[model samples]
Target chain A: MKKDLKFYRTLFISTFSLSAFTFGGGYVIVPLMRKKFVEKLKWIDEEEMINLIAISQSSPGAIAVNTSILVGYKLAGIPGALISTLGTVLPPLIILTAISFVYNQFKDNAVVNAALKGMQAGIAAVIIDVVYDLAAGIIKKKRAVSAIIMLGAFIAAFWLDINVAFIILASGAIGAAMVIYRERKRRRV
Target chain B: MIYLKLFLSFFQVGLFSIGGGYAALPLIQNQVVEINGWLTMKEFSDLITIAEMTPGPIAINSASFVGNRIGGIAGSLAATFGCVLPSFIIVLTLAYLYQRYRKLTVVQGVLEGLRPAVVALIASAGLSILTLALWGEKGISDIGSINLIAVALVALSLFVLRKWRPNPIFVILGTGAAGILIYLNI
Candidate 1:
């Protein structure tokens, strides 16, 4: 698809704004991205958007960053990926740079102390919500193996104090082994 | 030396946090708090708050926050880049390879297993933080000092999220304001 500079500019601006204004992390960006990429820009169809989300979720990294790169690559190849990533990082970098300077100054102040202390509970709750949200999605799918893995992983992580990296690696191995064994058994039957 | 350590720490964090943003939290805590001795447990919890209020992934925000604390903006850049480099390369390769072989069972199986594990990782991370929030690192020493207000706030936030599920930004901001008013007396 031959395109002009406007394509790149829009990709940059839209991604920049999305990364800037959107909060609450990766999952939050999906629908907003669809609205822009699918409905507004028509750069990608709905299925492609869904595919990007699936890929982003399955792969490592933040979903927002991953999708932005894919969308950028789709529009203009490697350079598009680079530009969109620049857009993605720019706002957060600037915002964080500014906050870093001030955080040291006001972190120990009275109001800041109370605010952070108060927010601590809320932060805990939010993390709980993340846990629930993810579990809900998996449970709704109703896969017994997935459910068992979730429970087992919780034990490994929380109780056993296993390293998270190893838990993931082990889970993936079990999951693959289960799939393979089941398939082989079915073929025999 | 600080910069190199920062890069390596975050690099390890980025490479292994397989599921999503929140999945990275435990690793972040380990590398920053346990290994590096950069921040206290309390300060680490506060960093989560700062990251929560910031406008990006918790991993990136904390990388920025931790780096700045250690070595200023230059450190921030090094840590941030280190945090993202693994993701950048992995995703690009996956995007390319996935398009070619979307049906590989190994690929599908790994993704399948990772989801539930990701859920577990997140829950584990949350409970630890909740423990810190409510009890403050001393179950035996300071059992009497549990913060009831924070507990109430946690209940309220969870209820709101479950029922309304509104924008998380508002929920966080609301708690901040409520936290100020409620915690000011304490």
Candidate 2:
């Protein structure tokens, strides 16, 4: 089970293809990654994929890229992580750069302008779908604490317009506090 | 100098962007729009739309696009590197230690706390974009700010998403075409 040159190549190529083809963000890429790495390549197992998913979700980056880094690290090492990131990132960077060149011309064109505006609406709808999907998952779990945290976050952002960083750190703090409280309660028992 | 700024600002984006890429939006708006004034609210919304349609995460695409705009190809590379560096280091380090970290009560609690918060951030990002697209930057009070065509497009797009559930790229492209037709009719 040597992770030779061929291994890194496969790591780079598979992630490249995954990032290149997948259009939507986190929700789309993570599952596809599992299929490719676990189901197809047999590079990692189901539990490993699940762990990677959780790590990627909690970590501070694009879940897509983060997952790529995990699978790459698991397979190879630091170099694997670097190569896989290049694979995942290159597609969007290349495409967006090309688009930028013609962007000014496209920006002012009537058809393009109209289409872009329409795309905004479409994008909004997509965001709605993401929201619904995530919310449904949370609700299905039926955790009162989670529900309260979710609502608190919504209000802080939507109504108060709080900075998101503070919200995240604060939420993390609250979670840490919860653990401490539970620990004390268990000791008392 | 410009490259440094591109690197630093995006480094901040990468560092603070928790719960995934969409959660980065508010922070991005703050840096690119409010702090640096690199792009307007309108432009930022457009950035999100384009990034959404593109292949990578919104944070990376936006960094590339903005960095390119401000500093050229070097800027693009710099900003992209800045955007990804934190994730690479953090995720790689965590991946190894995660087996142990997952068991810690504090770590478990933090992850749990962040989940709902992440959802809120994403939902809020969506709401902010909806607000921007529909009513411009005026905090939603003025009915006059509403663009009827954009509103119409919103309903149509939502229906398409619910009914067909096609690849999002196609839906976005279709709406853009519809946008052209609306302008043409006018």
Candidate 3:
């Protein structure tokens, strides 16, 4: 028991630290996580890591949080999950709180204003990068149905100001139906 | 009671908000702004702008900011945790069964299909952000043609810089300067 606890604690800290410093979310963290959990810790293999990313992306919540929980649980079960979640969340929570407090104090400072403006522009770039990468991945896979779904969703939300939840649910249902239809067709054949 | 409600609402947001942090925005807006009256649409939009400008995931930052605005520090903590809890629980559960179930052909096919959907989900998120950035209240409609030009220029510059692999900080600084220059001229 003591040995297990020690191992979990170490895993928690390492995972938390990596999450804390990661600049971009999701894909950017993939290689880093692969190194720590797969290469260094030997906690999970490469295939498991890929599987985790897939599951994490499909599930609700941040990918980083999902990844941590999955990895932590894989290593040490429920207790591992708790520790990993805390580790991933704590750093950003602390840092953001500090920044928010300071921001409130200096809300009107010109220099700070300038810096924020610059940061906003950078953020736009980051978001663009995220979109570009995701688009490239989908295009590479040549999934026309998925691409159509994405394009449709984007048009709906962008042009009509439709609620996003409805779009996602509708797309998910459509995807599931397509799968079922494919299965039935195969059986008939 | 309000704190609990806040917690539960954010929990729902976290529960269904797949893809990534940005994907949660429209849902967050719907729940917190339209349904609950916790924040006005304008405030929600501003919060998104602030979230984008800040580091960390947009959802968590929005949670903290919105929570702080609605119910102070305690509210902030509650909302933040709520947003994170679902993914935390679900991933853990899935991880346990992952080893045994990962190889099933059905499971593989489903995941393979889900990938494109996930991509679509993310692309929708990006489009939503673009809409907000370009056409929300302070958007091209109100800000005039110059702002539209600014948006186009920024978008173009971003695409070029991304291809060139220049340091992102420079692009950020440059955009800020442009915003300031435009604001000053106006």
The lDDT for every candidate, in the order shown, is 0.82, 0.84, 0.67
Clashing pairs in 3: none
DockQ of all models, two decimals each: 0.67, 0.68, 0.41
Candidate ranking (TM-score, best to worst): 1, 2, 3
The pairs that clash in candidate 1 are none
Worst 10 residues of 3 chain B by lDDT: B137-146
Off by over 4 Å in 2: A136-148, A158-161, A186-189, B137-141
lDDT (10s digit) by residue, model 1, range B1-186: 999999998888888787667888888887888778888777888888777777777787878888888989888888888887777788888888988999977778878888898888888878888988787666325667887887888899999988998776677778889978977876
The per-prediction CA RMSD against the true structure, in angstroms, equals 2.3, 2.5, 3.8
Tens-digit lDDT string for candidate 3 (B115-158): 55555555554444454545543444554533464476457657
Candidate 3's residue-wise lDDT over A1-189, tens digit each? 244767877887897788777765565665788899889877788987888887787677888778877877767777887888888777666665555566556647665554444334445555677667777987887767777876776676656666656776677666766677778899999
Best candidate according to DockQ = 2
Better of 1 and 2 by TM-score: 1
Model 3 interface RMSD over true interface Cα atoms: 3.5
| lDDT of candidate 2 over A75-139, digit per residue (tens) | 77788888999999999888877776677677787777677777778778878877888899988
